[model samples]
Target: MQGYSAASLKPIFDTHIKNDAQVLADGWCGYNPLKEECPNLKQTLSNKGKNFKMLHIQIRDFKNWLRGVHSYCNKEYLQKYIDEYFFRFNRRNHRKINFR
Candidate 1:
């Protein structure tokens, strides 16, 4: 979101995430307001990214891919790049069927 505040994240959370969906997040104060709406939301200390190794790895890999492939990207189209990267990453094991 534009900022890591409860106000900045609430709208996106309300629109895209179901109230009952299990939401896992770091212990950021920004998510405090969401608990009332999302009963299943859980927060834990990030422990300097060590608590979520795989997630951090994926983020790092995506950044590397963006730097290596695109070199630079316009902020306006950054979301499109992220969507495309995840789309391909999600289907990496099904390449044979992905084209069909």
Candidate 2:
């Protein structure tokens, strides 16, 4: 949600996330705004609240993957490219690519 405004998340969540799907995220303040924007959303932040619903999916995994592909990539592009990379990784024998 770095580059994305609260308004843009609707299409992304509706189209991509679907229902009954769990969302794992970090402690970024941007997600706070998303609470109102996404009604179905179950966001998790590392910094606030209790009984963390959001899985603290390691940024290192994604960052290393993105960094391996190309440096200077920020969170805006990171989500897209990481999804693409994970797709390829899942398809390629589950061996996966080393981003580092």
Clashes (backbone N, CA, C under 3 Å), per candidate, total 0, 0
Question: Counting only residues 3 or more apart in sequence or on different chains, how many pairs clash (N, Cα, C under 3 Å) in candidate 1?
Answer: 0
List lDDT for all candidates, in order: 0.92, 0.61
At residue 55, give the lDDT of candidate 1.
94
Off by over 4 Å in 1: none
Which stretches of candidate 2 lie above 4 Å from their native place? Answer: 20-40, 48-58, 68-84, 92-100
Q: Write the per-residue lDDT of candidate 2 for residues 1-100, one digit (tens) a residue.
A: 4466655565686688756655665556655676554555555545543445322244456667677778777767767887887787567664544442
Q: What would the TM-scores of all predictions be?
A: 0.83, 0.42
Q: Kindly list the per-residue Cα lDDT of model 1 for residues 1-100, writing each as its tens digit.
A: 5888999998899789999999889998889988999999999998999888889999999999999989999999999999999998999999889878
Candidate 1, residue 93: Cα displacement in angstroms equals 2.6
Candidate 2 lDDT: 0.61
Give the Å error, residue 51, model 1.
1.4
Winning candidate number (TM-score): 1
Best by lDDT: 1
Sequence-dependent TM-score of model 2: 0.42
Q: What lDDT would candidate 1 get against the real structure?
A: 0.92
